[model samples]
Target: MKISNRSTSTGRRRTSAAVALGAVLALTATACGDDGSGGGEGAEGSGKGKIVFWDNNGGVRTDIWKEIIADFEKANPDIDVQYVGIASTEYQSKVDTAIQGGGLPDVGGVGAAMLAGFAAQNALEPLDGRLAKSSLNGKLNKDMIESLKAAGGGDDKLYSIPTSANNGVLYYRTDLFKKAGLAEPTTWENFYKAAEKLTDKSKNAFGYTIRGGAGSIAQALDAMYGQSGITSFWDSSGEKTTVNDPKNVAALEKYAGLYKKVTPAADLNNDFTKMVAQWDSGTIGMLNHNLGSYQDHVKALGVDKFRGVPQPTGPGGRRVQVSNPVDGLGLFKSSKNKEAAWKFIEFALSHEVNSRFNESAGQVPANLEAAKDPWIEKAEPTKLAARALSDGSTSIVQLPYYLPDWNTISKADNEPNFQKVLLGKLSAKDFLDKMAEQLNEAQKEWKQQNG
Candidate 1:
């Protein structure tokens, strides 16, 4: 759901505005009637009507959809899909309002983290039977499907299928590395040394850039926790809060260390755009990020500016990758075009469409068949990402939605403590203890709300 690598020059507020303008334009141009579904509650004059699909896959991936639309229309002359692209930031709140106001889309986008929240509210229709009957049953990446099922709950009833699979990795300026005689950092200790050596104080250069904006510092924290094998709150079962675990404390220590040596003084307010800009300008030597914005970098600085490496291993001997599966579609329970929506979903997941999307968008496809495509092997970032996904040792953090109290636990309680800890304003022990206490409170409240 999160697009990585935004340009540093475009401020967040401006970037958000631009995306919103695009969304408004797309919505106005595409869906202009009494809803795309063509009727009320249970009206049944269907087969050749329209289905609204709200998503943010508007860049290169949108073009792929245009091509797919041609093919799908040719195959099923009856169904017309009105595609509306919404910016990712506005997606959750906007969709929630629409759903509650009784104006939901027939089929809507669901990112890995958003799926479980929506499903928990019964906003999504189960697709277990539909997937089995369609040609797409065997075409998707098994791991991605399993992840979706996990996000949707253990019932094996899927609400979304990832359009792509992604894992965060280390991207560094190869030229900078060579100048400093530094190879990729295999361990946390080595990474620190490299950061110290590469930082040129005279040129205002730092070892690595980071995202420290309000809404994004947690992401940087996620990368640190991931690289250090720290659990945010609950353990793997999603049962109990444990953000204060000793391992988590260790992760915070590592983060504080990173802030001390590698990061720039201005990094406390930096975002992805700023970090990538610093990197491109040769001011920073390294960064930890997702590949979503790789294309933008290629456009701004050219293809030769960067290369990918695995995330550095922590003290625990684990190299975890902070990841979120690609956004995909899910049917709404109140759809008049349920069958037609399923048909389109089936079409979208087919090998032909999957290949087209991956090829054009530069995204690693979620289809098992598409992963074997020659293009994937040829792309450096894609190749490294694919290798990590297929690596059996890799572990996934639960999507934000899977943890019901994620909002309160992450934003309200832990985030402030995390900031204070990182700034050395709060001792790591105090921060962790407070985080644990807050998470336990949230878990108790959530149980009461949902039980």
Candidate 2:
């Protein structure tokens, strides 16, 4: 399934080099149909009355999706849903190729990170009109709907519907905190002090774990906002980059300084899996991850050992966290069976089906009613996150999700520079400056192209 708040992987090592190569392939590869024509088999209006649906995380969530598809098909005897599962890492490349080469699926999983890119290519069908007439109109979360619209170039048109959300959390060892006489880390100042006090270098114990590989940018961004007090990723009109703001630079510097003091040197190359494994197996005081890793943490260190809290706050006393990356489903523009596909989408999003899916996936369902499911109510992380979101104590820093080059800049380019910062080879100012420059250029180009 699409893991929230972090990149989905099979606990494999995802180095910067590997990710760069994948980004290169995704960008450089070309296919026919630049004019948005379906030139080959399974092209628009070409499928033989069968609904071909693709699962973004093929092997990871194939069985679960297959079960859902089976239920859909069984309920509608006349329609046959063809299932195809694609790995998360390769899904974007495959979809990009399909958009240009033909043979797009009727409906498929689309990540928040990739939504703008795909929508910009004119590959997705707008679903705002269809959603208004369906049962999902009042059921889906309103904030999430706004998020989808902002991601879709802020045109007030939704190209995809949110399926679930993963919120940022700080998981800490309760026993260790009690032993150290430290209060729960509720603020950045307290968290830093606790990290310092918890570190026992001779015992190989650390205060926190850092993610320097693959998905480092998001974690760093969260830390930056928590310390900086900046609330948005761009200016009012979305024409500037805020990465290099003085406040943000100070935040990044402070965050990077935690390395070699409260964190292990080995953390410089750790991905989420390796970092989570380290925290799970060792005497770590706190770990930064999302709700997606909740199950893994619970499986490793039972419920009594640790507790998950929302990300810490800054001096302003507000918990400033970035919006959790969303997982969504989009309708392809080329699909001829739009009506039947909408039926399937509506069915999957029904209260009961939505509850079942999120319960199995261990994420907060996008359906507002599904959030009240007993399974979610019993889960500590979900409950705490819901409180944080609704209590008005947490401020979500909405990034410019409409930026099509976000994946390339954030993942492929920003990761290696972050690694350099951790290694002391690059200064935080330099890193943010370079990142801001690249993003500014991208923002200008996007305006020129779209306007």
State each model's C-alpha RMSD to the native: 7.9, 7.0
lDDT of 2: 0.78
Flag clash pairs in model 1: 8-273, 48-78, 233-242
By TM-score, how accurate is candidate 1? 0.78
Q: What is the lDDT of residue 347 in candidate 1?
A: 78
**lDDT on C-alpha atoms for all candidate structures:** 0.63, 0.78
lDDT of 1 by residue, 1-451 (tens): 1122222222322333244343333333232122553223322225557777776544434666777777898899877878777655456666655544455677777866666556654567788887787777787877777778866733458898678765676777777778788877666777778788888777887888766543353464566566557634467666565556777667667766667467786766665566666666666777776666566567666767667666777647776655555567787766766777777777777776787777666677877787778887766777776676677555655544454334334443455555666688888778767656645554554455446
1-451 per-residue lDDT for model 2 (tens digits): 1111233222112332243244333333321212223432213343225677888768656766888889988888777888889876568777866765566777889877788767766677789888998878999988777788878864668888888887998999999999999999989988998899999999999999888877789899999988888888887878787878999999999999999889988888887777888999999999998886787778889999999999998866888988776888888876666666777788888888888877766678988888888999777987899899889998888766677667767776678889999888999999998888777876776577568
After superposing candidate 1 on the true structure, give the runs of residues whose Cα lies further than 4 Å from its correct spot: 1-45, 56-78, 153-155, 201-204, 214-218, 226-238, 256-261, 264-282, 360-362, 389-400, 411-434, 441-451
Task: Give the total clashing residue pairs for model 1.
Answer: 3
